[model samples]
Target: MVKVTFIEHDGKEHEIEAQEGLTLMEVAVKNGVPGIDADCGGACACATCHVYVDEGFKEATGEASPMEESMLDFASERQDNSRLSCQISVSKKLEGMKVKIPEFQG
Candidate 1:
C-alpha cells in the first residue's frame, strides 16, 4: 500500500493507506478526505479535485497532461505545484507524499 496525506485548506489532514493503482482523488474520496470533491469521478473533466503536490514529491507525481492542464485552468487558487488529484496515480514512490487541498474547488 502507498501511504498518502491529504491536507485541507484549513490544515486538517487525512492519512490513508491507498492501493497502488488508485488515483489520489480515488483514495481521498474512498477514505472520506474532505475538500477533494472529485465531481468528474476520475474522468479529468473538471477541476473539483484540485490539489497542490508537495515540492518533495513533484517528480514522482509528474507533470499534468495537456488535458489536465486545461481543466486545471478552471481550478481556484492554482499554483505552480497545483495538480488535479484524479490525474495523479498513486504508487510506491508516493508513499508519505503530501498534497494540500485548496479552500475551494472550481
Candidate 2:
C-alpha cells in the first residue's frame, strides 16, 4: 500500500494507506476523508476533488492532463500546486505524498 496524507482546509490531517492503481480521489472517498467531495467521481469532469500537492511530491504526482487542467478552472482557491485528485493515480513512487484540500469545492 502507498501511504498518503490529506490535509483538510481546517488543518486536519488524514493519513491513509491506499492501494496501488487507485486514484487519490478513490482513497479519499473510501477512507472518508473530508473536503474531497469528488462530485464527478474520478472522471476528472469536475473540480470538487481538488487538492494542492505538496511541493516535494510534485514530481511524483506529475502534471495534469489537458482535460484535468480545464476542470480545475472551476475549483476554488486555485494555486500553483493545485490538481484534481481524481487525476492522480496511486503508486509506489507516491508513497508518503501529501495533499491539501481546499476550503470549498466551488
Candidate 3:
C-alpha cells in the first residue's frame, strides 16, 4: 500500500493508505479525504481531482501524461506541479508521495 498525504490549502494534513493499482483520486474519494470531487470518476475528462504535487514528491511520482497535463490547464489553480490525482496510480514507488489540494478544488 502507498501512504498518500494530502496537505490542504488551509494547511490540514490527511494521510491514507492507498491500495496498489488504484488511482490517487479513488483513494481520496473513497476515504473521504475532502477536496477531490472526482466527478468523472477515473476518466481523464474532468478536472475536479486537480491537485498540486509537492515538489519534493514530484520526481518520484513522475510527470503527468500529456492528456492529464493538458486537462490540468483547465483547473482553477494551475501550478508548476499541478496534476489530476485521478491520473496517478498507487504503488510502492509512490508510497509517501505528497499532494496539496488546490485552492480551487474546495
Q: Over all chains combined, what TM-score does candidate 2 have?
A: 0.97
Q: Lowest lDDT 10-mer window, candidate 1? A: 8-17
Q: Model 1 segments beyond 4 Å from truth?
A: none
Ranking by TM-score: 1, 2, 3
For candidate 3, list the clashing residue pairs, or say none. Answer: none
lDDT of 3 by residue, 1-106 (tens): 7788988889999989889999889989898987898888879987999988878878877778888877777899688888899888888988788889977752
Q: How do the residues 15-88 of candidate 1 rate in per-residue lDDT, one tens digit apiece?
A: 89999999999999999998989888999999999999999999999988999999999999999999999999
**Model 3 lDDT, residue 32, Cα:** 90
Output the better candidate (1/3) by TM-score.
Answer: 1
Can you rank all candidates by lDDT, best first?
1, 2, 3
What's the lDDT for all of these models?
0.94, 0.92, 0.85
TM-score of each: 0.98, 0.97, 0.91
Shift in Å, residue 29, candidate 2: 0.3
Error of 1 at 81 (Å): 0.3
Distance (Å) between predicted and true CA of 63, model 1? Answer: 1.4
Q: Report the lDDT tens digits of candidate 2 across residue range 12-104.
A: 999999999999999999999999998878888889999999999999988889998899899999999999998999999999998999999
